[model samples]
Target: MDTTTNALRWVFLFLMHHPDIQDRMCTEIEGVVRRDMIPMLEDRSKLPFCEAVCFEVMRLGKGSPHTAPHTMKQDTEINGCVIPKGVPVVFNLNSINSDPEIFPDPSTFNPDRFLTGDGRLQGTEKMATSSMGRRSCMGESLAMMELFLFVMALVQRYKIKIEP
Candidate 1:
């Protein structure tokens, strides 16, 4: 179905599988935001661990590997290969998501990757979920905001786990 909805499902599944992560995210939510206050976009930065969880979910649950086709504006050399102008290009989200060079042990659902040594939110804006730059998904921010709020609210209210 929808890619954002798919990723959201993955997030809950991951949390169900990893109670430690869910607890940590809940702790972050509990410690940072007031119980009566609804989590907002501004609160996102205050909860780095939660953001990390979201980033990790986005990284692993990329529903569509290849993006919409785009044509190169000019000759572009990437790494070593050269792409001529007018050539079509489609970024593979899976490739970037699983690239060992960028994410060590890429297959693991390690939210810590988005955190720094002291446990602060790092540069997760570079995640492949929305691609990058002008060509990125127009609703990326809205999607992320929805995801952040959802995960925060859900974890705070419920103990996610396997039913069986």
Candidate 2:
């Protein structure tokens, strides 16, 4: 493969293998879901643990890492950095999502941090980081619902094993 293609492939694998995020995902799913009970869309809102896991996953995944870019329509300053008018800019999702200040122990995937002791999201307040806004992933809701159903069905109907 060409260098560009090879580079893309490596990046894909790196995201897939990100240990802190990936392991927490598996652990959360394995904990709340039993080997029975088919997960449904109706069940999503009730699945606090599952939702938390999804949030943390998205935070770490930083969906489409380098895909979204925007342009400055007018000269602007953000976080003390100034941008010239009409300048192109890219938002590196990973950096924002994984900021240690915004997310305590950002590198560690801890879904509980997104939740309360009663097992609800810390708040219902919407933020761009909540996957809302012009830059939001259009398919976020559909993809999340699909993933929950798919994983639940697989675990209920079959035994999955990881080989050493």
Candidate 3:
């Protein structure tokens, strides 16, 4: 789908532009993941920086510009705007990802945003994107795993260099 492919493209582009971040990702992946084996869900936690890169892709990249339409079961109010029950509403993911409060200097592509002061990967509890939430895509979990593995596979196997 366009969403998944766009995520890959964005990840590559971001890494290409930010080799320091890419190097950190590779270092993290190499530290925990074996070169001969493909990464698995169990490896997700050990590879914090890799997971952070994937998270950054979903957050900073416009993987899915907007969510699918859904009708609310109960009247909902967001920022004083009311959407009565039975009304279809679509959320723009970019708006959520770019919230100044959630992400400072949102324009910059920084996977470190998902990390803590000590460089530990922050949990995903507060991470929100088009594919995450109650009404999220059915393949949310699988897609997230795929994103992490996809990036992990690449950086683990090859170095991404930007040709001037």
Candidate 4:
């Protein structure tokens, strides 16, 4: 759990310092949500900008760089690489997520890529954070929901700024 905890802490600290992201996130929240109403799960679909920010954060955030381990059940080929059955596989999420082919200019933190021309999330489905097969992480839903709420609450409260 240390890996997960440290990753989350780092992400929190990074967001706290990044004024551009904080300003954009707050503006998006303020535009969609009334000040009086607390953000809820129902608000998620209506808040595409919010979702995009969260997606960008997740993409950039190295939360749990070392994902939980999994063992291969049967022989499989992925990306032209073949593995025999019963081989231990460590899915380096960091590499896959930050790969340039998958995310252009992967090292740069940009939220605009996730948005459509009209300022909505471009993807129809959430990207998978864990393995697709039988050994996928079980906490996917819980983690996503928690992260979303935490970010929304932060936006609702603080108007973030960079100290010069």
lDDT of 2 by residue, 72-140 (tens): 889899999999888887766566676676777877756677788887776323212324456666665
lDDT of 3: 0.80
Worst 10-residue lDDT window, candidate 3 = 123-132
Candidate 1, residue 153: CA error in Å? 0.7
Q: What's model 2's overall lDDT?
A: 0.56
Mark the 10 consecutive residues where model 1 has the least summed lDDT: 123-132
Indicate the residue-level lDDT of 121 in model 4.
80
Q: Count the backbone clashes (under 3 Å) in each candidate.
A: 0, 0, 0, 0
Residue pairs with clashing backbones, model 3: none
lDDT of 3 by residue, 1-164 (tens): 55667788888898888989888887877788778887778998787778888888888887767888888899989899998999988887788788888788888887788888977888456556664467777776777777887888888888887877
- lDDT, candidate 1, 20-135, per-residue tens: 99989888888988988767788888899999898899888876787888999999999999999999998888998889889899999999998999989886765787566789
lDDT of 4 at 134: 60
Give lDDT tens digits, candidate 4, residues 1-164: 43344435644665767767777777777887899887788888777777776776667776656566667789999999998898887877788778787778977867777888988788524344654456657776566667677778877887654466
Give the TM-scores of the predictions, in the order they appear.
0.91, 0.66, 0.87, 0.80
Q: Report lDDT per candidate.
A: 0.85, 0.56, 0.80, 0.70
Output the lDDT of residue 88, model 4: 84
Which regions of candidate 4 fall more than 4 Å away from where they truly are? Answer: 1-11, 78-81, 124-128, 162-164
For every candidate, C-alpha RMSD to the true structure in Å: 1.8, 6.5, 2.0, 2.9
- What is the alpha-carbon lDDT for the whole of candidate 1? 0.85
Among these predictions, the greatest lDDT belongs to 1
Query: Pairing residues by index, what is the TM-score of model 1?
Result: 0.91
